[model samples]
Target: MTILITGSTGLVGSRLLQRLLEAGYDCRAMVRGGRPKPAGAHAVEGDLFDTESLARAVEGVTAIIHLAAVFRTGDEALIWKSNFDGARNLMAAASAHAPHARFILASTSNVYDKSQARPGCESDAVAPTQAYPASKVAAERALCESGLTWTVVRFPFVYGDGDGHLEELPAHLLSANWHPAMRMSTIHHRDIATAMVLALDGKFDGHVVNIADDVPASMLDLIALSRGEMTASARPLAEPWAMQVDTALARSLGFRPTIRTVFHAAEQQLL
Candidate 1:
């Protein structure tokens, strides 16, 4: 079966492409511009905003893993165009070219309310305050209502494999005041790849799955991961709160995390 992957050069997508090839799936990497394609996969040049490019990319693929999104941006227009408009374009292409193709979207757990005391579940109502999460919510709605087989996998602070995603915490903290006690759910890149592939089964269609580790990580822990050590700090931006996600639904569908925590990542020097 052929699978087309968007954002194939990104942190999760790059590793996912390698994993898919190793598992013997015929893969197509949909790349923008001169980005180098994965060695074993077929290459298709495309931009999410370009309808012609999207049409070519969507043709004849058995499945389309939609991972292209904009995060960490203050520009609302760019965020909406990339995350929401891009998704609509791709979904439209899939509908026209490959109507029976399985569609998998990569989403974030930040769509949930920050004040929720328990972990966010798939059935809970989404309340996205930021432009990034709001765009994803719009994308999810489009995919679900598009009359296609689809799955939405919500990720929470994925880290590992020297991706330097964790290293950006210092800069993130600089822009917003965060308390050291703030906590968030997390997952490893390896596990994310695993979940994406497993989601291809027809049984998971129309489901929203949360992919995360068993335990949540604190802001201090993230800072430690960022600096490679722990330190004390008193910041007004952070609140003593947590936003955990329930992954039980995903686990029921045969999803198991290979890297259970960021500490394991540090041990393997992936951080």
Candidate 2:
């Protein structure tokens, strides 16, 4: 079966593309910015904003792994356009061309309500406060309502593979009104890729799945990882269990993470 991967040049998508090829699946990589195509995969040059290119990207593919999104942009308009409108455009194309194709969307655990007293779950209410998470929520809703086989994999903070995304935590903590005692749910890039593959083949059609590591990382751990030193904060988490997501559903669906914790990241010197 052939699979089309959008954002194939990104951190998570790039790795997933390699893994999919290694698994002996025919792959089509939707690429832009003159990014070099994977050796064994066909490259379809496209932009999410370009409907024609999106149509070209989805032709004859049995599955579409959509990982392209705008998460760290300062422009609010760009965030909605890239996340919501992008998913809409792709779904429209897939509906017309590859109606029966499996569509797996990459969503975030941040879409969960942050004020709840317990860990986030698939059935929990969502209240996104920021543009990125809000856009993802909108995208998720669109895909769920679209007339196609779909699965939404909600990921927590994905790190590793030389990703410096967490490295900015030190500055963010200093500048933003973030609570130091707040814990973070995390998953390695390998695990996220595995989840995507699982979602592609698993019996989770028309459902949402949460993918995360076994344990939650404290803000102190993140600060120490980002910076060379660690410091304590007297402020406690808004709710004791906030940001700790429940992965029981994903685990039951046969997703066992090879890297169970951020400590593994330290072992590989990825932090």
Each candidate's TM vs. the true structure?
0.91, 0.93
Candidate 1 residue pairs that clash? 177-237, 178-237, 178-238, 179-237, 179-238
Clashes of each: 5, 0
lDDT for residue 87 in candidate 2, whole number 0-100: 90
Top-TM-score structure, candidate number = 2
Query: Which stretches of model 1 miss by more than 4 angstroms?
Result: 228-241
Q: In model 1, what is the error at residue 207, expressed in angstroms?
A: 0.5
Instruction: Report the number of the highest-lDDT candidate.
Output: 1
| Per-residue lDDT over 26-104 for candidate 1, one digit per residue giving the tens place of the 0 to 100 score | 9999998878877889999999888899899989999999888888678999999999999999999999989989999
Model 1 CA lDDT for position 104: 96
Model 2 clash tally, residue pairs: 0
